[model samples]
Target: MNSFSELCSLLNQVSSADYKKILLKEYLDSSTDSDILWALYLLSGRKLRRSFDITGLWEILPKLAGLPEWLIDESYQISSDKAETISLILPVDPDEKRITLSEMIKFADDISELPDSAELEKIINILKSINAEDKLLFLKLITGAFRSGINKKDIAAALSEKYSITIISAFHFLSAADPYEDNPDNLLKYYKRNKKIFSSYPFCSAQNQDTASVFQGDCKQWLAEWKWDGLRVQVIYRKGELLIWSKSGELVTEKFPELFRLSQFLDDGTVIEGEIIAFSKGRPLHFSILQKRLSLKTVPVSLTDDFPAALIAFDILEFNGNDIRSMPLTERRKILASVTEKSADQEIMYLSPLLEFKSWKALAEIKNSAAENNCKGIVLKKKDSAYSGNDWLSLNLEPYIFNAVLLYAQRSLNSEMYSEFTFGAWHNDELITFTKTSGGLNEVDLIEISDFIKANTIEKFGPVRTVKPELVFEIHFEGISESKRHKSGITLRNPRIHRWHKDKKPHEAGYLSNLLELLNAGK
Candidate 1:
């Protein structure tokens, strides 16, 4: 546990990707197989079920530390992390023994089996026996909030370097096999033996079209398709079973039962990649409609009838139990068209139609009119390029931008130092909060904004501070709609900060009337 805590601290401090990979490799080399497996699992953004109530901890920690609850609450407001707050306030013991990561995990598992009184006693004893750093990690683990700077890509790269395997293979291994159940000593062997039907390949991503060099060449070398505004998924059928895997590697076969018709149509050992759009009356609906189905574990008949789902099959990755990723996209598209035509479920699965364009100018004009067809934009794929890397490029429509004044600042849940800002627009001479966004700010900008927020705070409401509405910012979003739930009577989709308007006055920001006008115009 001490070593694992140190590793997390070191990972948090480093900025260089290569150095982080080195640290990860070193940790893997030094730790036991069980410890390494759990560490990788946690670092890869997986967590055990949180067994204890966090609110209960907030109440109990004050009693154990002999400190006022208000002090702990205030410290939590500053840190924005419960683990850090409790670790800092609790009294530390000088004579504490080191614990292993597995032991700590086992303690967490044992919490559910013990009685409430026994659990509280165990927690108090463990807290008293561990150092502050270990205590922080243990608290985070039991609460299922153990997050670090490390990502799956970094871990895959470290494994690739250590095992002399390809990064893609390592990624597939990491995504497919459960580290808790699989033997770390036989990681490669198990990855090779695992059924391919249960695993999803690394999704092929797209670069922004403006930055890609493919456009500089002949337009004839590329194929254009409408970039659907829906969820990207990989449909897999193997061993007489069908599965739908999201881009994030979640098994979502049950989420869209309407797509289960593919099992009768698609051949065994075939994998098709496409977008799952909410279709109604033969047209794709907005992503907001499709999002309703994403969280449903059991889809009701009424919901399916209202927002029916369809797959716009665009590419074929595997055919007849063979990996065809290395094949040219032009060849794969031919195979894809043939496969989809034979499926017979044309309403549920349709081939994404290719856009015909003679020149880049014509293509640009078509891209500008993407929203008219309810598409995000256009995607360009090199006809001769393989399906492995980022041979595709996406040209998305420009986001709607609005200038608004910052109204409130609260500590961000994702980080300890940064704060999420709420911005408001003038509505009938009153500042009304419209949206809150935490993205699109660098570390330097975050620090500057944090300092500004501290100096301009007018009132405190627990973790949130009402700030003087003086600073203005440009906010960017995809769409807007009317809503009765908000005081502003409007909602913006996927809003994020675009830039801080240092020279603009609060009065110069946009008004609620303008947003309503834009929303009505869209309708």
Candidate 2:
């Protein structure tokens, strides 16, 4: 428990990824398998099964420490944390020995089985034996509020380095690790096997091909497909078994049993990459409908009948017991068309449509008009590129750039960093606020903007500073829709500052008419 507490303290101090990895590596080397497994389970954001609920803590803590409600509230307001306040006011006994991690969990379970009076007394006595840090940790564990700033991937990376395994294998192993079912030891065995037969390959990402490059290349050498607004999934059927993995590497087979039912149609040793979308009356439904289905742990028969999940198999990674990732995409598509053709459920499973364009001009027109077909955008892939190749580009038509005026800037809590800025557009002589952007600014730009904001401050209100509406910024966004909550009466999806439009004036910025035109045009 002391070593675990020390590790947690060390993790909180370092901000560097390299330093965090070093600390984790050192801790892993010194700890036993049981201790390391417990640490990893906590680090990966998993908590113990609740043996007791601490819902009454607010009432219990004040009485236990003899602190008034007002003092506790004031401390919480200042510290911005409840756990820290409880730990600070609670009485401590330094002479008592610390309990082991396993003992702590066992103690909580044992106390939970007792009556309320005995349980409360046992908890208070246990808290007295541990330090403030461990007390907070133990309480968080029992209450299921444990969290660390460290990324879960870092834990996998550290373990991979320690065991001399590939990062991907380590990631999959970590995903399957669970302490309650004795899964940590099983994960070590799976790591030893290193089998990726049914494991989904890490998704291949596309780079943004500039307009110049798109025009410079011949259309015949490229393949175009609609970028479906749905979840990307990989379906694997092997050894009379089925598996579905989301792009994030989550096993989602159990969530959609309707798609899992299609496994019988596919042959063994087949793996295909595709999109999971909701369909109704032979048309793809809105992505929001698919999201509703995803949120359900088990899809109801009635909802399944209504939404009817479907998959558009876009690419084939494996076919008939052989890995075909090295094959050219054109060849793979041919194989994919043939394999999916063997399936009986054509309505639930089919190949994605391949757009035919003669020239870049024609493709651009298709891309601009994609919204009419409810398409998000278009993907361009080199015909000769392998299925595993990274030579693919995604271009969206809705997210067109527009010039906007910077209306306000907000300062960061800790530093003088100008973290967020409110942007607005001219709405018939009024500078109405629409969206706030906090990212996509370089350090130099931030400093320049910060200095300009300080020199031109007009008014101050809390963290927000109203500056002279003289700064114009070129904002890039995804789409515009009517929004009553915004002062401009419209919402800009994912607005980000592209660059400082120093050459433009506030009066010359965008207007409500222009935004309405965009909304009407459905661009």
RMSD of each: 7.4, 5.2
Cα error of candidate 1 at position 80, Å: 6.3
TM-score of 2: 0.76
Question: Which residue window of length 10 is worst by lDDT in model 1?
Answer: 190-199
lDDT of 2 by residue, 1-523 (tens): 2377677778888767777888888877777666677778778766676645665665778888888888888988997767677777787766756556667766767776789767767877788888887787777776677777567668777877877765655655555565556655567776667455435676887776656666765578889998887789988887766777788655667667778766767877889999988888877765656766676645799988998888889898888878889899989999898877876455768899899888888888888777666567889888889865478988766567888888899987566878699988888688888888887889989999999989998999977899899999989876666766677777776688888878888888988778889877753
On TM-score, the candidate that comes out on top is: 2
Off by over 4 Å in 1: 10-23, 54-94, 145-180, 192-225, 231-265, 268-271, 280-283, 288-309, 321-334, 341-348, 353-372, 377-509, 520-523
Which one is best on lDDT?
1
lDDT of 2 at 330: 88
Per-residue lDDT of model 1, residues 1-523, tens digit only = 2388889889988767788888888888888887887888788766776657667666788888899888888898999998888888888888886677888888887886888777877776887888888889998888777887776768887887897655544665665557557877687764455446556677888787563454477889889999888889999888776778778645567678788888888888899999999877877877867776675536799988888998999999999989999999989999998889886555789899999999888898899988877787889998988886567888888989999999998886545554688999998899889998887888888888888888888999977999989999999998776777788877887899988888999999999999999878865
Angstrom error at residue 74, model 1: 6.7
